[model samples]
Target: MKPTTSEMEILQVLWEKKSCSVREVHESLNKKDVGYTTTLKLMQIMLEKGLVVRDSSSRSHIYTANITEEQTQTSFLDKMIDTVYHGSTSRLVMQALGHSNTSKEELAAIREYLETLEKS
Candidate 1:
């Protein structure tokens, strides 16, 4: 399932921490002023969506993201390219570069990646 923005925030926490309790996730997201129960409910929903796995053997059930960050980002990028750019990867790249401040090093890295892709 594609995670909502709130769920994505929780997923980010899980990816960084590897595993955490609801309380830990709530604490880590202190900047948002979200209630503990709200965080808990979101996690529960994520569990139902198969976005996360919970270990309930312990007192504080630990949760970890079922999906990898790379996998999620690739899905998001693919959907964005298809929906927003009409399946044109070049259009997506052009728009992305046009909006951002592209550095020489970043360009060099992109070039290197393209070279690697060509080799593959």
Candidate 2:
């Protein structure tokens, strides 16, 4: 399932923390000053969306990402490339590079990856 932007934020917290309560999730995003109730509500919605699993056995429920980070990234990237890039990965790459200020080090890493791909 594709998570919304807000849902993705919550998933990121869960992915990083492994398992945490709503309060923990809220604290993680406290820099953004997001409300506790808002985070709670989003977590509930995420449970319904099958994006997270809640352990309600204890007083404070624990939440964990139902999907792996790589799985979600791959899904999002595949959909984006298919729709926005019209199924052309090279076009997507060019467009991304054209828009972003990629550092030389990052570009070198990308070049290395491309070389590996060519070798394969």
Candidate 3:
């Protein structure tokens, strides 16, 4: 299941923290004006969706992401490549590189990765 924007935000926090209580998730998302209850509800919904798992042994109910960061990134990238880029990964890379303010170090890393891909 694709996670909503709110759920993604919560998942990012969970991924970073590895495990977190609702309050910790809320605090991580403090930049947004979302309420504690709203975060709680979203987490509960995510649990139901199998995006997250909760440890109910404690009173705080710590949550962890059921999916890995790499998994989520690959899923979204595959969908975007198929849909938005019309199944062209080169087009997606070209568009991304063209538009973004990619640093010299970043570009070098990308080049190195491309070289590795070519060798394989």
Candidate 4:
């Protein structure tokens, strides 16, 4: 299932922490000004949706992402490329590069990746 924006925020914390209690996620999301109960409720919903797995053995329930970061990125990117870019990866790349100030190092890394793809 595709996660909502709120769920993605929680997933970001989980991805960094590997596993976290609701309190940990709530604290990490403090900048967003989300309430603790809201965070807890969202995590509970995520668990039901199979986006996260919970360890209930302990006093505090610890949650971990059921999906890997790479998998989520690939899924979202594929959907975006197909729908938003009309299946044109070049269009997506061009639009992204045009709008953003990409660093020289980043551009070089992208070029290297392209070269590797070409060789393969």
Measured against the true structure, the TM-scores of the candidates, in listed sequence, are 0.96, 0.90, 0.95, 0.94
Runs in model 1 lying further than 4 Å from the true structure: none
What is the per-residue lDDT of model 4 for residues 1-120, given as tens digits with 9 covering 90 to 100?
A: 889999999999999999999999999887666678999999999999999999999999999999998989999999999999999999999999999999999999999999999999
TM match of model 4 to true structure: 0.94
Weakest 10 consecutive residues of candidate 1 by summed lDDT = 26-35
lDDT of 2 at 120: 100
lDDT of 1 at 107: 97
Query: What local lDDT does model 1 show for residue 30?
Result: 80
Task: Point out where model 2 deviates above 4 Å.
Answer: 31-34
Candidate 1 residue lDDT tens string, 48-76: 99999999999999999999999999999
Q: What does candidate 3's lDDT look like per residue over 10-40, in tens digits?
A: 9999999999999999999986667899999
Return the lDDT, model 2, position 76: 96
Off by over 4 Å in 4: 31-33
